[model samples]
Target: LDIAFIVEGSDNVGEENFNIVKKFLERVITGMNVGQEDIHVTVMQYSETVTLEYSFREIQSKESIIEKVRSIPYQGGKATNTGNALNYISKHTFTLVNGGRQDVPHLVYMVSSSPSTDVITRPPRSINVIPIGITPNANIQELRRISQPNNPIILHSYSTLIEEAPELVLQSCCSRKLWTEIPELCNKPMDVMFLLDGSSNIGASEFEEMKNFVRAFIESAEISNTSIHVSVLQYARENNLEISWNVPQETEKLVEMVHSIQQREQGPTRLGRAIDFVVQNAMSESHGGRPSASKVAIVIVSGRSEDTVEAAALSARMNRVSLFPIGVGNRYDEEQLRTLTGPSAANRIMKLQNFEDLSTMITLNSEFIKKVCMDPVRECIDEDGNKKKPGDKWTLPDQCHTVTCFPGDYTVLESHQINCERMPKPVCHSNLPAVKIEETCGCRWMCPC
Candidate 1:
């Protein structure tokens, strides 16, 4: 569970009003049952609204989190432009939010004392935006701007300030043993770099497969709905740019663009070359604003390659972007295949194990892409702002609730990310000391494990 908070530190408000805002935030934090270890706190104070405070990661102790929340100094000036604060928090802070991949919930809490006169042109990226208006005159437009009236995006008002703090915790970290498994993808923008194999060794069918996988991801999760922007080209016989940086939200165009891929070109499967392409590109785009989610992922697929993928895989791993390599067949390098999984067994690069069924393979790949895009796709966007792209969507599991970094059901978590393809399997971590659910998985017929 990852939690990010924003409180009005607008300069125009009075000291008394400032204190009320701080206390209101503190009470809510205390009541959320947010423990020290369960959350990473970021304080954005708005006077002229520069991110007055940055994030303090993983404070498990509620007192520690509260003290940090209280540490926000009061500043008052003119009208409360909550939109600026929201813009700052949306752009400047939040990349470290852990539960981004649509598997773990990410929660953004906004407590404001005034209104925002500006119209947000940038889109909002996080999954759930919870806006609580502390003042009677608090900007309802800003509140509605941050939230959706229906579903997870909530905009509820109180008659007065939160006079009393709830004595009990909203939810406990340890008690919610299932936290990691729950499908809670945040609406924070994510930084994703995809590395594709362009070598001639990758076949026509495989090329089409790769292209569609990218297309589905671009259409279903990218564009206006997500923060994921895919780059690079097919590395086969010729190297060409299919998508530079922009990702299409609507599937029709992306699908058309990909299906129309008449050229399958690039050099020898330079897997390392592709990974390096992303690393170099990503470093330059590092905007100062704290993104809604932390880290990025490098995805690679190849059938054959002369150079080793170890160095590239390790480099991406160090950058906090995991290297996911898909091996096309027995001829593909298993060592490199395994290497992409990284240092921990949990990070082991998983193979399709069977490729006889293209539909299953494509479905599995699509599911993985959906899970991966959920967070950064959420992060890279500004909810109240203009839609970057439109006609894309990724729905969360029912067990999931509005993002709060809250713990989720135990069985649904596998790698702390959800893969919808394996429905009813009670996805779980195999490396863990124990296994809980006994129910069989939906793909049991195909399982030879």
Candidate 2:
């Protein structure tokens, strides 16, 4: 769930506007409903060379992160080396690490007022690039290529149309799962159990194809040692465990071995049995000291399941396993996966129309994992800077938390890099001593600044 913001512009915004934008950005980032720890931010300004205004992962302290962003002065240059900026990000920001499970999603938000330089190079698969076209000068074609959902109509006038183009900003910065719908849900770790259809409806070949899609999607992320325990249950006419969850060390082997299965278009899709088996059997049983009573997620994949799915689904629901269904092939059981995803859960379920393109489908789901699962372990310092563990509710004016500690204005500008050239020393401002404030109404109330 690491969200990186890149501000690119040939003509940098003026200091006044820049400072305003910086403060504005601070407010926006801190005010975002996502948990502070779940939201790690990095600032990069690109002109001739991509200058790391502030390094990645350095913004852990909300206050410090704000100060660094405020310190950056906008600098404008004649040429915009967007391509180079991307390359620098790939080479320096994210490097492939062995232990990293490639599950986290990394997003780049580029506020460019112009097109990328003619220079071109290959981009990393690990990074999802999103460009915010701020004006007519912004290149539309390239922006679409970099952003998700492929096609996008570039908003040409950021200065004049920000209010009109709210969706544009959101799509570029969608860094979390259950984001728009469940804005408060933090991306945290979880124990996931996969229940796959093994009926005649989806044969061995289609199942193997599904496995590859899931693997490819999970493998192309920017996370290390990501905790993902998968117990796969295959249910066609009968339900059986093709893989187990307790053995963490041999998880990869289990995933790898799935490809060896022969696709069998078995007679019936006994999806109910598979669902019941995993939720009641696998998740409820303790393995290697890990309690089966822990939070569980059941990911079901199939074209369609049994007719008696509701009976088994009720059992799964009663057992408290969060269900997510990824429908494969044209025979998507929309009703089944939809009901299982939760009537109110954010990002409930989606069906893939084609199995041959299942890899791409899984890739889309992987984005969900990356954006919504940053704080899987879920205990982190709240915005109040108290070690209140993750998921605690400590908001503004309480302590040294970013949401309250640093509240300021922010602006999105197209300007030169202020730090790139030699400049006079800027006066340092002293930090204000924090004053104790009460959460009287549990609602924002007007108070003296």
Q: What local distance difference test score does each model get?
A: 0.48, 0.52
Q: lDDT, candidate 2, residue 200?
A: 69
lDDT of 1 by residue, 1-449 (tens): 55556666665456776777677667766665454444545556654555545454444566776776677667665656665666765654545453222344555556665666555533254434555555445654355445531111112233234553222112222234212232324255554444556566666655655554555344334443344444435554434555544454344555566667654555566666666555555433442112443445445454656666665654554444545565555667776666665434324354654222222232222345444643222211111222222322222232221112112211111222343355553433453332333322222212222
lDDT of 1: 0.48
The per-prediction CA RMSD against the true structure, in angstroms, equals: 24.3, 27.3
- Per-prediction count of colliding residue pairs? 66, 39
The residue-by-residue lDDT of candidate 2 on 234-307, one tens digit each, is 66777666656555434345545555555455578767666776766766555321453234554546556655
TM-score of 2: 0.40
Query: Which 10 successive residues of model 1 have the least lDDT summed?
Result: 405-414
